[model samples]
Target: MTAATSISPIPVAPVGLTARARRFVEVDSVRVPRRGLGQHRRKWIEHGAPAVEIDRAAVFQDRWGGLALPPAPFYEGGPRILGAGCPEGSTDEGWSFRAGSCRVSMAYGFRIGSDGAFGIDAYRWTPLHASTDGWVESLALAAHAGRWAKTVTRIKGKAVESLDLVGFEPVPEVQGVTDTWWRGKDSLIALYRGEAVGLDAPRCLEAHVYGGLDEWGLHGG
Candidate 1:
């Protein structure tokens, strides 16, 4: 008897995405406490705040696993839920923020220092942009980094001193570039040697390529 033959299904490609769609992005955020943790939580609860439950495993991976990229649409609109390392009943339970969509999935960790001060380390990502508008749209999507930082500050009743946007390009060693980092209209200040400098002054916003793939290995190193 002849051996049985098997057939393989043909592969299909995704529809509707253009060539300019962004396949990778990363942003790191930091915030400082402006008030005590208890006071902040009380204020948040008083305002009918939405609570974000901490996903312990997610937190561990984020703190130790580098960047964890979320699926499409990137930012999901809702209360900010961060991962934390604390006992169930501890006052230091994970934090939650008011719900809203910035078009990226955000994951972070909150810590209260020995001195009773608090801080946040956050990571945000999106797998694709799908925009036909070109680079400006990509930059605009990235500009949400500031807004995300500000939202966290508002929830924690803290001040956002600095938030940096670090672009992660899928391509190796090419270096991702953006026209402007800030989303909204704002002043750009230049300083040199403790004095104000012109826009023509040298300024560098660098991008470094870190070699690694997501858990799914969709992006090759």
Candidate 2:
């Protein structure tokens, strides 16, 4: 899923889901109207956002704007992805703008330095992925694994440290730096170390195991 950052053409991104999004959470994909972006851009300019940067942001919104991803364990405790329908001004962008937020209004946007990597606030940048597709890929992975795993377990704080992961391999598609997904023979473990680091609370460490996955479920059919 290569996201193009251009304004002349209406940026189009694949809806990123098939017929199965309803399995784990009922996901609604809404198309953001291009006409509304003029006002969104005007708002960004008043906030002193750079034009090229704003255009890139606007282009991203034009493409992947309206799909709100359901929250997983480590996500912001609500829908992690924003379905805001338009870009909103934020001091967090430095020169760009913001679009997504969770329960605490913790903002998420594409990073300019990383050429549009999606992440949380400006300070932490991306605790998520190297690109927008990586974010979508993570959601897809979570949905697929969560649906098939017959037994689910959640652990937090110091208990996360005791997990034995000798045979578990990191799921590379997430492109995770701090948080990661580990796939074992029959279990997929989502380890969220970034949460504790971001909030300055060690007890925020979390890990969820999707156990009882068969080969089909583990790798997807």
Candidate 3:
């Protein structure tokens, strides 16, 4: 028998899985909606007054990455990009990425002043097609909240003198679920669940300021 020459198969880069295929956690059942400042602005207007002008320069004051935000371990001095998304610049923008099974959108705006007094309004949204399980929705909500907390920590750092859980409102479909939080002298956390309402009816999570930034928390100076 003629010895068969061993032929190595052509090396092919493995195809990356889609967001849905790589689902490993229950929260992954839901899909994150597209990102856009317009959607967030519409929602803010519908609920109340026009959205505040986000200070892009201030928000990324400590950021080191180029266009896309990097993932944690966040930048030591400021907010770190968590993953690939839109480039930073506009006063308002949307960031979308996968966190476990949950698709998260950190649609936010900010206004930091010379005195360090600032306001940050961050809105989290998921697609209505997300898992209908109340528990799942809650988990997703918590995941997004956690991410937001880290973002706040990175940006405000020790400069945060006082932190607040300003607002935690859910979409109409998820209004039944009550979101709650705890505000200590330095830290605060809010958790809840709801449908991802579009511009027609958008929910918000906001924080107002009384003073300025501290070494690691908001303060009154």
Candidate 4:
């Protein structure tokens, strides 16, 4: 098994996303407490993430394997999930290896293909993005956009399909299939389709609209 799921296509962030992707995506930052165990530091460095992302004294490999909830859409996200995708063995698929357990199910994570991008680890080597930074950027956007939006309208079950995304532009930072984000003039629409697709439960489909936002809330630090 690798990071690709047979149900979905290979998630590619693509070279041309929205204008927001032109510059660095700003997300809500948080403090992560890492126990410095430098055992897997070398792999992290080799993975091509920024040196500042993980410390030399921090434990790199996941001593504790992440628990994947079969197939579900309720993947609670945070920077911690990245920690779950710890380094794993290597493969012939572009030297793909386990990077970290995403903590959002999909069997946690596997830094698939040559890009070393994080995603489900299975027969398919689909990646969440072209690089690790893209994942972080997408996660940050999800965390911050909801908080800033004054109104968060939720849609679930059959209602989720009714959401019209006519004017919204796809947010490519996440490069998600079941989970996706869209940007509108004054709002952000997020959809959680993991459960609906993974479990084959149409009612599990859910969506949210984050409306009423200013520049600061959307992208400002």
lDDT of 4 by residue, 1-221 (tens): 34432222222222443433323221222222323336556777787643444431132233212211122223444223234333333545534444444544453344544444544444444454555445544555655676588988888999888888998888766676546778888888878765565455688688878889887665543
Give the Å shift of residue 167 in candidate 4: 1.2
Q: Estimate, for each residue in 87-149, the C-alpha lDDT of model 3 and write its tens digit.
A: 222333342222111123434322222222222223433332122122222333334344334
Best by lDDT: 2
Each candidate structure's TM-score, on Cα atoms with residue i matched to residue i, is 0.16, 0.71, 0.18, 0.52
Candidate 4, residue 117: the lDDT equals 51
Query: The CA-based lDDT of model 2 is what?
Result: 0.60
Which scores greater on TM-score, model 1 or model 3?
A: 3
Q: Which 10-residue window in model 2 sums to the lowest lDDT?
A: 2-11
For model 3, give the RMSD to the true fold.
18.8
lDDT of 2 by residue, 88-202 (tens): 3445544434545455555343332324555555335544566555566667677788779998899999999999999999887776666778999999998877657655667
| Native-to-model Cα distance after best TM-score fit, residue 73 in candidate 4, in Å | 10
